[model samples]
Target chain A: MNTIEVKELRRIYKTNIGVIRRKVKEIVAVDGITFDVNRGELFGLLGPNGAGKTTMIKMLTTLLIPTGGTAKILGYDVVDQANEIRSRIGFIFGGERGLYWRLSGIDNLRYFASLYHVDPEVTMKRIPQLLELVGLSDRGEEKVEGYSRGMKQRLHIARTLLHDPEILFLDEPTMGLDPVGGREIRQVIRDLQSEKKTILLTTHYMFEADALCERVAVIDQGRIVALDTPEALKQVVSDLSVIEIEVFGVPEEILNQIRNLPFVDTVSVEDLDQKQALHVHSAKGSEAIPPLLSALEGVRVGKVTVREPTLEDAYVRLVGGKV
Target chain B: MKPGMMKAYVHVIKLTFIFTLKQSMTDAFILFGIFVQPLLIAIMALFILGDQGDGLVIFIVVGSGLTGLWDSVLFQSGNSITRERWTGTLEALVGMPTPLAVIVFGKNLAFVTQSLSSMIVAYAFASIIFGYPLSIEAPTLFIISVVMTVLSLVCLGLVLATLFVLNPDVQRWQNGLEFPVFILAGFLFPIAILPQWTTPLSYILAPYWAAVALHMSSGGKPDILEISVPWAMMALLGVLYLFLAFWLFRKMLFKARVDATLSGQ
Candidate 1:
């Protein structure tokens, strides 16, 4: 059974601009997007900045009302039955801002537990268990302001699980964390899925989705461009091969020359320390390499390799408008 | 509401009250509003109105005490929700199954309760330091009036919190609101001294009734029949402001979601 059913959901913001002559500007942040998440499934929403990932999450979580269309969580309408839905769902936005910095981590949980109306006896037992689950049992006594970013994030996870809602909406839960912190959160998420909780996660990190999501949706400009399992989504770029070249300084002219090559599908530049890594996608595979080097003959070059396209390559193809 | 649900609501309110009170106690601004500001005003009022007599000295004490209460409700209770928005916890509170108004009510309760210290602080300053014997003329009526003042002020706080969140432009008038209400509510003097036109305006304010009720029982020397007028006005105004707040809370939440402005940052 589907835990979440979203049909053509939309959210538009109208704002007035200017001092004397005010002009109303309508921004369509989420435009008629539809998708579903089945029970016990881990769903991922992949998109670049301003792609409506957060907006859609806000709509489903009842933080923002949809301007048009409809969405249901566990068979309750998001608009009309918000209270019924709020009781059944738990959500955490990315970053350290949501939790009370002045309160201790355990106090934050106690406060939320009260808000969720968990029985006082149950809260007494559950708060410590959740603290242990998030590996913050010892530090739960400290004020959240004193916590590291990772520790505060762990506290947020514990808070979300305070009432143990059936559905969890985590909007980029691992955002702005070190690799260790991100991995720890991912481990907690994996554990949650084992407990049969339906999870909807949105993140810009492609591999994080590929590694954790049961199904992934690539959204761009308020619309879902592709929705499938990670393996199937990668098939979008399966025909294309990636040629990576590390160079000291490939001037704009040389990069443009690479862009103009006949078989080159797309070329993106990544800045490394004192070097620029050129990612070239082409169906010509290794046959497109020699000509590419000739274009960069004057530049000091380092390592060069040809590899199979991954899920991130598929995302770049989908969101970068190459597909 | 079922008995179980009512119990749960009480539980939530109690927790929210304790949480807000603890958090507010750490704030220096709140401390100043509740303690220092009122004491300072009491000293200044005693200096000016000192030689009048013991009855007027009690007047200064009650008047200056009300100033702190008003400041606390005006600034602290007023910013309860806005402060949550600043800390990014407003969205979390709004999303919960518990009503946002319930939590805000608890917070205002904490604020108004803590601010009662202003009255005590001023009372102590007058009786102990200034060496004036101060006593309530009608102790039972005075206690009842104090209860009414707290309830009415908390309800007024509900209105102010919602109004400030709804139109930030009104909040921009926050600093400007303090002294005008002080004058109109007769916190320091009688509203009768103002123009007759402002009397009707003062009549609508909950603080004005609170002042009249507190002043009468403490030192104004009103009979039971006479003091009942301000008590009735406070009760009526409390109900009116609560209904207004109930309506404003719904409107503010709807607008916050529509405008997607819950995250002030």
Candidate 2:
């Protein structure tokens, strides 16, 4: 059964410009997107900045009303049955700012516990258990201002669980964390999954989605371009092989020439200090490499390697190389 | 509602109050508003109107305290919701099962209660440091008036918080709103001294009645019937402010959701 259902959700922001003569510009942030998250499923939304990933999460979480279409969390309408939905769901927007810096970790939890209307007796028992779960049992007395970003994030997770919500909406929960911190959060998410909790996470990190999510949706320009298992989504580029050619001074026109080849799919350049690396994708595999080299002519070349496409390559193709 | 839900709401209010009071304690701006500014105003009032009579000391103390109360309401209570937005917690609060107005009401309760300290501080500074003997003519009535003042001011604060969230231009004039309330509320003098036209303006403000009731009980003992007028006005206006706030809160939340500017600067 679907725990969260969204159908053609849309959000448009009207911005007024200028002082005297004003002009209204309507920016469609989320444009009629439809998706569903099943019970106990780990769903991920992958997109670049301003691709409506956060907007979609906000709509499902009832933080923002949809401009069109409809969404239901645990079978309650997001617009009309918000209070019923809010009670059963918890969400965390990625950042350090959501916590009260002046309060201790325990105090913060205690305070939010009251906001969620947990029995004070239950809070007395649950606070410690949550602290232990987040590995902050020893540091619960410290003010959030002194806690590291990772600690604050863990506390945020603890905050969300105070109500023991059935559905969790995390918007880039690991956005700014270090690799270790991010891994710890991913572990927390994994633990939640083990407990059979439903989670919808949005992130710009492709591999993180591949590692954590059961199914991932790749959104671009306010719409979902592809939705499938990470491995299945990678099949968009599975037929093509990626050739990385390290060249010292290859011009843009030469890269364009490789794009014009019969088998070449897309060509993108990555700056590598003194040298620029050209990533050329083609369906002909290694057979297209010789022509790619011939197009390079007198451009000083470095090591060239060819490999199968990963999710990142698939993401690149779906978003049309916007990454 | 059921008794269980009512108890839960009370518990939520209790927790929110304690936490908000603790948080405000660490803020230097809140400290100045509820403490330093009031004491400074009290000292000026003492020196300026000092020598008039012994009764005037108590008058100055109550008057200066009202300034602190109004300042707290204007700045601290007014920005309660905006402060949550700035800290990025507005979304979390809005998404909670409990209504946003309930949480804000708890916050305003803390602000107004803590601001009451301005009166105590001013009273202490007068009776202890300045060696002026100050005592309320009717302590019971004064205490009751103080309670009414807090409730009414909290309701008024609710309106301000939601109004400021709904209209950013009104918040831009927040600094300008301060002394006008002080003048019109007659925190330092009688509103009767002002033009007759401004009396209706003063009558509409809860702070004005708060001043009337506070001054009468503290400085001179008035009969129950005489003092009940300000109390009734405060009660009536408190209900009006609450109704206005209820409407404003709905409009503000809807607007914020539509605009998706809950956490925006």
Candidate 3:
């Protein structure tokens, strides 16, 4: 069964400005968007600022009522059955925003545990396990205000899972972490996915989407532009193999001559050192590379590299370079 | 409701209480010195008003008691909403499985706790330190006190939590509930002390009547049965505010847009 189902979601905001408050602005933060998150699958929403990623997540989480359409989590309607939905979900937000600064990290976790109504006995068992899982077992007694950003976020990871929720809403869990810290959080997420938790992760990093999400949705202006596996999106632009070539002393006119070759659809000459590169674009580009290499036989083919198109490249071309 | 919903209120109460205590402790030292201000004011009212000494003392006790409770409860309930809005804790709560009612009820736990504490202090001071010459009919005073605190705090939390959600900066203005309540709530003097022209504003808020009911129960010449109308009025306002607050906060939650601002942790 789908763990989360969002259909034709929309949201609008009315703002009044000016000293007289006469100025009115209506902001459509989330436009009609639809998608489903299957059980135990990692889902990703990718977007720039103001692209309505948070708005969409809020609607699914039932934090905001949809202006249009409907949604469900674990088969509970987001609007009509929000209380049931809340019981089944665990949520973590990035940075210093989620945990209480004054409370000890353990206390914060315990407080939320009470909110979740874990039996006191189960809570005792779970607290230490979560503490160890987040690797804060020893420091659990310390207050959150004194902890570093990464440590605080680790505590948040523990807090979200304390209720043993079936679904997780992780909003930018590794947002400002260093490379090592980000790597650690990624490992934790990998572990959670292994445990068969349905995860909805919103991230700006293409690699994070690629590494964590089984399938990704690129949302812009409150709508989903594309949804596919990272490899599949990369395939959107993989019809043409991208090859970088370096050469020595090839003239622009000669590169133009190479461009006129029967198999070549487009070409440009550029110098890599003293060598010139015949930058070539062709339909059966892989098949045409041998001919292009033959045509530039006199030119030293100093180095050639071919690469599979990346999701970011697909993001730029198909998802629009703006978003 | 599931057992989880029942316990959710307990958790909210714990958080609400702890936060209020933290806030009170941070301000307690300073208020500790001013604590004697009520004692002195009670004495002054007795001395100046002479024949009205008992009446005036009841006003003082009721006013200080209710205002003290109001001061803390308003911030407890309203400020929790505001602080959650500002710190994004409310956003986190929004994402949780906790219902809006549980959130509000739990948040009000702080104020309810504070109201109980402040009432104790106010009554203890009135009965012991000031010795302001009053005899409260215990049962009547107790019943009325409970009604006033329960109804007012619930209403204020419900109606004003939304204001905080709408304006995160309004947290600073929460004193708006406290200061006016202290001066005009008619806790030290009878509402009749105010000119007839001012009576409308004072009565629109229920705590004033609560104070009067306490004064009647403890110090006034009125019979116990005569104070029934006053106690009933206060209770009615409290219930109305409670229902209104509950409905308002629910609507606010539904209308909120709590979106994540970043991509990763």
- Backbone clashes for every candidate come to 0, 0, 19
True contacts kept of 1: 0.79
Candidate 3 iRMSD in angstroms: 4.1
Q: In candidate 2, what are the lDDT values of residues B73-149, reduced to their tens digit? A: 99999999999999998998999988899999999999999999999999999999999988999999999999999
Q: Candidate 3, after superposition: displacement of residue A79 in Å?
A: 2.7
Model 3 C-alpha lDDT per residue in residues B123-181, reported as the tens digit of each score = 67766775655556566565665666465656656666666665557767766656666
- Model 1 local distance difference test score: 0.91
Every model: Cα RMSD to truth: 1.8, 2.0, 7.6
TM-score of 3: 0.76
Over the stretch A1-323, how does candidate 3's per-residue lDDT look in tens digits?
A: 58898888888867678886588777898888889999999999987767887777777777677778888899999888887888788887667786678778877887777767666678889999998988899999987889988888888899889889999998889989999888888988999999999999998788889888999998877888899999898877667555557876776666667767876544545445666644454557567677777777777777776655567556655545453
TM-score of 2: 0.95
- Model 2: what is its DockQ? 0.84
Off by over 4 Å in 1: A248-253, A321-323, B220-222
TM-score against truth, every candidate: 0.96, 0.95, 0.76
**Comparison by DockQ, 2 against 3, better one:** 2
Clashing pairs in 2: none
Candidate 3's C-alpha runs over 4 A off are: A12-29, A237-309, B2-15, B18-24, B27-62, B115-157, B162-180, B197-204, B216-230, B257-265
